[model samples]
Target: MVPVAALAAGAAIILSGCSAGQVSQTADQVAAINGNTAEAGSIALRNVHIVFPGSGTHTNTAGGQAALALSIINTGETVTDELTGVTTDLGTVKITPADGDKIEIAPSETIVVSTPSAGAETHTTGETVDTEAGTTEAAAIEITGLTQDITPGLTYNVSFNFKENGTVQVEVPVDAGIESPRHESELSKSTTGSAGGH
Candidate 1:
């Protein structure tokens, strides 16, 4: 026959074991319930527009320096999670005519950000300068660091680096296929053109 104290201790051990099992079961159930409800969200950039400062022909002496403006509407619902970094891939930023010059773009909001174009000093004497004739430069604007959340129905503006001869600001339109140069090895050698801009 066991002593009364020993019986009490044994019963207590059994109760504790039961309690632990119940707690583990409850936790497993809660996790299973949440697993089904979890879903992934998305973000989209849309209605992008890049505009040149002036439609008039830029002088070759002004070093073909010009300004480019851009407007873009970022339309997408924010994720419950946070995005740390969002950036645009502006290919090799360089001034036209290979004058060894460069462009600089001052960062700003949705409004115009002034980026200088290449000047005439960058071009050779005999070269007939056109918008594309000048050296094309590329610079990426980092948008991810600006905010914690890029919420739905919000617009963010990013400016490219200035080109010495002239600035080519691209307006990335809605669903515009702005390919990533980092992935394309060939883009490193290809020249950037003014295909779509205002």
Candidate 2:
């Protein structure tokens, strides 16, 4: 069982950059509003957002790569967890972290998966990614062979596979709201990088 205090802290981290009725809402918010559970085993995923290209309002073209942003909090006190990969109906999520490894969270630690360095942004085009490139701490997932079946403001089924716990499935929201400060920071850096490149 997850500690109440730990869950509370996890909730706080998920809500750090969000408010009500906007993209600021975390994955927990989406899950709660959608009547789903964001916690699985000792892993709790929150504040998840998907990007469909062309800012927060436009949708990505078919075959275009999409991005994702979310936070994972390990509530276990003694066990560490590994996020092996992500999968969707479109196919397996192909993201080679600039750092070269799957995400591993220590007990009671939280890791946020966001934009990748140079290759892709959290959920935007290369132009969009250039506006938010600095930290490669987060993993950047590039969805290949994507078609027009997905769109923004809609929900999709995604599975996150862990080394020990197996797969946890959830519906992720394609949010364009810049409510998450960390999420926004990527944009800020992207803007800076874009300007500096000239």
Candidate 3:
């Protein structure tokens, strides 16, 4: 027994609620990252992850070597900083610079660090520096004598010691190498099929 105006208003409200697009619809459409990040003072470490040993191998055995990959950014406008060293309970981190023993980062500069020894097949973040462009410098951060297996889905705590920024501890993960949701779904289907056969 509602009035015509009331009924129309109700209908309008219902139509508005059922409209096409929504902010919540886009909520699930978010960006995904593979690595962890940490900030200390003016320095920010982005995409800190460990490269799995060799291509096709998903795990690195204990006591073996693993490469740590990350980009160190100096956010300060004027103050230059130096990466003094890196340490972790997992192993000893050797910082091999392209030129000298010192890893220097000028203000507003980014130093890309990775383990080149792991070879190009497995390296995820450690990219080669373009010497022709002569813009960014690259260094190698290798973790040797690992106490535990370095595998995907496991995170290890690593400390980055900067001369000016002190020390920042970051929990870094090993790369699983899954690039998209479809890839994950396909793998899941195959896994399900395998389980059903057993």
Segments of candidate 3 deviating more than 4 angstroms:
1-31, 55-59, 117-134, 178-198
Score residue 3 of candidate 2 by CA lDDT.
Answer: 98
Q: Between 1 and 2, whose TM-score is larger?
A: 2
Tell me each candidate's TM-score: 0.18, 0.56, 0.70
TM-score (C-alpha) between model 1 and the true structure: 0.18
- Per-residue CA lDDT of model 2 for 72-173, tens digit only, reads 778788887788888887644776543446677667766656653322234332221121312224555656666655665687788888887778888887
lDDT of 3 by residue, 38-141 (tens): 99999989888887565432236788777877778888988889999999998878888745678888787778776544542332333445433233577778
The prediction achieving the highest lDDT against the true structure is: 3
Against the reference, the lDDT scores of all candidates come to 0.27, 0.60, 0.74
Give the winner by lDDT: 1 or 3: 3
Q: Candidate 3 deviates by what RMSD?
A: 6.4
What TM-score would you give candidate 3 relative to the actual structure? 0.70
CA error at residue 85 for candidate 3, angstroms? 1.3
List pairs with backbone clashes in candidate 2: 18-24, 27-47, 67-123, 130-190, 131-190, 131-191, 132-186, 132-190
Better of 2 and 3 by lDDT: 3
- Give per-residue CA lDDT, model 1, range 1-198, as digits (tens): 579889999999888787575476665654221001111122222223322223333221222322222221112222122222223432212222212222222121111112223111122322332332222222222121122222212333433322222222333322111231345576446566837546
